[model samples]
Target: MKKKFLIVVLTLVLSLTGASSAFAYDGWADSKQTAYQFQFPVLGVSIVLNSATDVDWYSYTNNTGSPHGLSAKLQSPPGLIYDFAMIVGGSTSYFSSDTPGGWVKVTIAGNIAPGETVYFQVRGHTYSQFSTTAPYNFTITT
Candidate 1:
């Protein structure tokens, strides 16, 4: 009886750990130093806000030979809104969704040169609903 109980407890713990990790797909780190490295032309990466104050951070490097335009867009679930921020070559720009759950795109007005790096930050809006299960799709283009 003791061995059976221990086995059942261990099984339940393992199952819960796996289930929790399954929802963490594409989650970014909270700080710029430990931000996720983003590749060019990222399409439809699913991410969750997790909480009201949760912030996701990403960094991308320009690998092209010449200067190129860069843009980032996001689509939140219905009834949710999101805020986006970008830092390119020491300049910062901010963007937010005009309509709830609609796609919002932020384009860098200036072109980024080769070997430059851009950092991004994403968070739920002040009045937005946060969810761990419901994710928003994000895209990055250059």
Candidate 2:
């Protein structure tokens, strides 16, 4: 009886640990759905910056219905700048419409100077019918 009890306890502990680890990454689960849309005559866009640790270096989207591409541009106020763009998620085929949208392993260049903020904007178009929440927002940590 004691051996059986120990095994049950171990299983419960392992299950809880796994569930917590699953959400440890910094990213959005539904970025495409939450994206703001422009009316017939206007352009609307939104940007989110997610601070991440070395384990998960960049932010990503978790939607399975459609994939979207993210473009990152690092701007340091007072005239310093750099830009990097990639299709972070979804099918790589340019003609496929069922790609997932989010960031991949791409890294940003330059550090956000003390008291300064770096901006990362992810944008894309999706035809899937779903609703999204705002992309996960992030702040720099010294």
Candidate 3:
């Protein structure tokens, strides 16, 4: 009986440890359905493109009862290329840059109506560059 109890406890502990490690990356999931939601006008939210296929998603809603302009600006690390995009209503605006260490901006205002939500995606450009030690930061401007 003691041996069986010990095995159960070890299994529980191992599962818990694995679960904790799964959420270590910026506390955000990798899909649009599980994307992290944040308030608009956010400044400098740090994120990482940890792998070649890692894509991060975020959403923001316009609830001001009026149309407001929205912009996504990404600042990539040196020697790495990144892409940024925004989906407002049915319209999509994408921005990509080959120049490392610069800010790429995407703006869409007229497409977002009052009470409408928009989604943003950030990822490595065409599997060109990814960094686990370096993080690319972004800002949502209104």
The number of the candidate with the highest lDDT is: 1
Sort by lDDT, best first: 1, 3, 2
Query: For model 1, how does the per-residue alpha-carbon lDDT over 1-142 read when each residue is reduced to its tens digit?
Result: 9999999999987655321221443344778887777653342367788887788887888787788887788788678888888898778888888788887887775588889888888888783467788887666776
Clashes within 3 Å, all models in order: 0, 8, 0
Steric clash pairs (candidate 3): none
Alpha carbon deviation, residue 30, candidate 1 (Å): 0.8
The lowest-lDDT stretch of 10 consecutive residues in candidate 2 is: 75-84
All models: lDDT?
0.74, 0.29, 0.73
RMSD of 3: 10.5
In model 3, the number of clashes is 0
Cα deviation in Å at residue 139, candidate 2?
Answer: 20
Whose lDDT is higher: candidate 1's or candidate 3's? Answer: 1
TM-score of each: 0.74, 0.22, 0.74
